[model samples]
Target: MTYPRSLLRAAVLAGMTVVVLVQFAAQLVLMVPGVLLGMVFLLPPPIHAGRVLVSRWRRMFANWTGRTVPVPYEPPPPPPEPDEEGLYRHESTLYKSPRFPAFFHRLDWLMKDPATKRDLSWAFWFPVLGLLPLALAAGPLLLALWTWVWGPPWGLPGEPSSGAWWATAWTALWERPAWLAALSVPGLVALPWTVGAVARWSAWLLAPGVRRPPSAKRVEQTLLAWVRCAMLVACAAAEVVLLAVSLACFGLGFGLGLVFLIPVANSHFRWLANMRRQFAEWGGVRIPRPYTPQLRPELRPDGLYRVKNNLYKTETMATFNANWQWTWNDIASWRDLVWLAADPVVTVALVGAPVAAVVYGGWGLVFPWVWTELFDADWSAWYGAVAGHRTLGLLVGLALVAAGLAVPRPLLVAHAWWTALLLRPTKAAAAEAALRERVERLTQTRTDALDAQAAEVRRIERDLHDGAQARLIAVGLTLGAIERLMDTDPAAARKLVAQARETSATALTELRDLVRGIHPPVLSERGLGDAVRALALDTAAEVNVAGELPGRPPAPVESAAYFAVSELLANATRHGGAERIGIDLRHRDGVLRITVTDDGDGGANPSRGTGLRGIERRLGTFDGTLTIHSPPGGPTVATLELPCALSSPKTSTS
Candidate 1:
């Protein structure tokens, strides 16, 4: 039963392999024309078809192996929507019809997805490897058929002998009929193993999320490092050309007065430097851009715009001059020029040398053997050979390749250090950059505070109008009704008075609740520590408060800290599924720090929750920061820090 089942599965896999081979051939045929002849429209269809085929195989293999294969492709882009003008936009151009934009979007989607390449690879390799299992399963049947039809070495009485040389030679080789039958048994026994092997190999490439074996991962890393080194070498060569062009442009702009070309060259080549800065991360260093902010022309009170000392009545001329001067005066611009001049020499020597050694060494190892042995060519002293000793050359080549591989990662780090030396901002420039960032953050926080203040005011007004004011109006009407009812009936007048009293009490409670929402009474009277304790009493979880401040924080800071803790507690209970929580408060080094830790299923993301973002904004008003460390399982800890002074302890007030 096992042997038959294995053969059945093998036959099905073999048929699938044929389909995969056809798909592979179709893709190769389309890819050539699509890439070379600009028929990109031909590319997506074959890739999409290949994905469908691969997806089916992935499911079958997963079912057979009882292991999951996650879908590795990114979600497709949303369909294009027309703007107010009823035109769809794709990149820079707008079109009346959605067809062109949709096509381009789909093309981008398919080409950019890594899974598509993996599918194409699977398509190519599966057909070649799939033949093994197919041959194993089918070999026994072929041998049986051959022996039955040819009647072993000697022809049967009724069987006609073949006169063909190949048939006669094949019949002569199989002397015994039993040997042919015996050969089929081993293939039948190996069928199941081959099938499992194919399933395992297919899953490795198809499942991107699957953890690779250590050896495979190490090899991939080594190859990727080599690729990165090669890319750096190529980029260094490109930078040399850019440096020459930049020098020429600077000469023309400054020396010959081609002022327009100056900004063009500066702006265009700046991206390459920025790319290199980004790539510097591979070397375990980060390089930030050093250019100053581009400020717009400020309109003066004298009815003119100022660019430097120069003033223009028209805005356009002033703006252009400002940009030109800004670029020209930036110290970073000169630093970039210097970097462009020096990068080629440094990068080529540091990064390129290893790659060159590897390439030359590989050539010496493989090509020399091929030329000397296969073609019987004379050995040359060039390459890795020494005095026509091919064996010596092979050994030298092997060592050189190993040496080349060993040094690329370290050399890459060295290259990054060199990049940082030229491209990173100077001390003064870094300070200015920090100041500019501080100003920007302050501006944003101010805007947020204003918006929040307006929203709070609107909320207060709505509550007053809809709750307290309406109840008070009702109380006044009831009192007036009582005035009328007193003369007619004393009993009804008494009842009306009682109803008005109850309504007034409810209104007062509503007003107090609204005030508490604005600034909690406990926070003002008892300070932040006692207020947070009062907050914890109302929460669902068992909360333990630890640590104490020596004195009270400023009212505003205390209020912000209280509310921030309240929000964290609420998040822990509501979303984090916390059962127990701990709150700690301290004033250390003039900074009030509050830590809230919760034992919960903790995966808190501030960006996703408005409660957290509101807490951040409220804290930001006082130059406070919220940092959370929430791993997936349990125990989320959120720390809130605010820089403020603490005053002497104040007496509790009613």
Candidate 2:
């Protein structure tokens, strides 16, 4: 009962094509049934039930193909989540516009083609005439096949291969009235078979288990569907007749009929195709797969056969039939189209001078008398001889014509360039948009990072000032009091002194721990180079630091660079599985560049950890940055750049 969408589509297209061919052989009268059959057969199923039927059909197909072939239907992609404003945004224009929906709905109605009222027989007459030529073109292939299978004459080449003798006898009969009335047996058979095929197709289309009628709830729905289809067929038939009459009446001017035929015929065919595909889909028939679109022109020459090949070359035709018309929505695509249109105009202008010269030169030689008559010039004197042949005049005339043709190229090119410029997006607008997005992102990141860092600093400062500092002050006061009491009461002083010693030791340890927490003493004493060396030495890493500053930089700059380098080295050793590290430092023109590179398992993402972010934030204060380059394999490089005065330390304190 139900068909695959593709199968229905194919049947509809195939049937429409066959009907069109029949019309081409016959006349407009035949096109009515063709249209009716196309619409009735191709009509898609209604919504809810249609979806259920399609799903069931798909499963059935999957099973039939032994699961090798995939289900025919591809579920629509999930819709985008609603934004903060609660407005839903769809990706396609079809979802957004009612006009497209209405257009397609009208097409569906035209395709359904229910019979509410019958059209006058004359209405179908013209379509038959229009389809006649196309049918004739296709007739030979079928006729040849029939002749080969059945001994109906029109036999195979070289000798009477089956039906040759019978065809000859029938041809002889066609010359007489009785024989003509009887007709060639082969012709009669083929004609009846074709017609019967069409009628069967139309009847099958009208039957149930195929396209169902529109819902009965809407009073005018069924009637309207029928009327719309009738109107469409009538229009198509009338157009065909009008075109024929135009050709008959005006002769050469009949070419203009295509203007009417192109739009209407294409729409008709499209409607027919959709219906066939839909019905076949409902009826579980498999349609041929669609081709991908061609993004570029093919390499073949643009001759008739080549063009035909290109048109049918799956992808190329797909691209042509697709919605690729250059629209103003996307500025880049529109601009390219503008430039393409403009280029010919520009070339024509620049080509004019040379073309004019050639034309003039050639014309002067052939028509010298005309030049004299038209311009009141003496051609004999132009030859510059006593018996002049107007050679000079001829040269000038030819030059003038050549110049006239040559002058237009540049003008045309300029015009074309101007037109393209008009279509092109303004750089200012694009730049402004980029700047806005950049600023917005940067502001959000900077604000969050700063807020986090400030909270951390306040917590550290409070710990040091309140807890450690207070304990140290208490210990100092106790020791001072014990010193004063030692002279006055030796025993009491001794006891006080012991207690003071215990307090002093505890306070001293706490102070040292706090100071270490604030900033490593090793870093200050030995400088960044030694701190890194100490880290590598302790961690058992093969660390190499080349181009270490011979002297320390400004304290803030040195501290920032040292910490940044230390963090990278630590990360590389811990996570990178790095066997070796190479560190480089250079100072030039008030800028310090430090690079720590490692040969390790790479693919390190800075966003995944705070180590890199901390390094970045520290460098931010001094207008510096840390850049990480880690791809999917080994060898990662971390570069830290800071604006500072670079110098070698004269003394080593650590």
Writing each residue's lDDT as its tens digit, candidate 1 over 1-654 gives 276777777888788888998889988899889999999889888888878878889998887667988777755555666753477777658889988888887787788666777887778888877777867656656765776776542342222253445445445445455555566667677888888788878877788644669998877777777778988988888898898787788789999999877876675578898999988888999987889889588899999998768989999888878888878888888888888888888888888888987888889675685566433456656754766766677877877788788788887788889999999999999999889889999998898788778878988999999999999999999999999999999999999999999999999999999999899998888888889999989999999999988899988888889878988999899878899999999999989999999998765655433567778888998889999987555579999999999998874797
Lowest-scoring 10 consecutive residues by lDDT in candidate 1?
A: 153-162
TM-score of each: 0.70, 0.32
Whole-model lDDT for model 1 versus the true structure? 0.81
lDDT of candidate 2 over 422-498, digit per residue (tens): 33336754565566666776775577567646765876778767776777777688778878887888888788777
Candidate 2, run of 10 with poorest lDDT:
114-123
In model 1, the number of clashes is: 0
The number of the candidate with the highest TM-score is 1
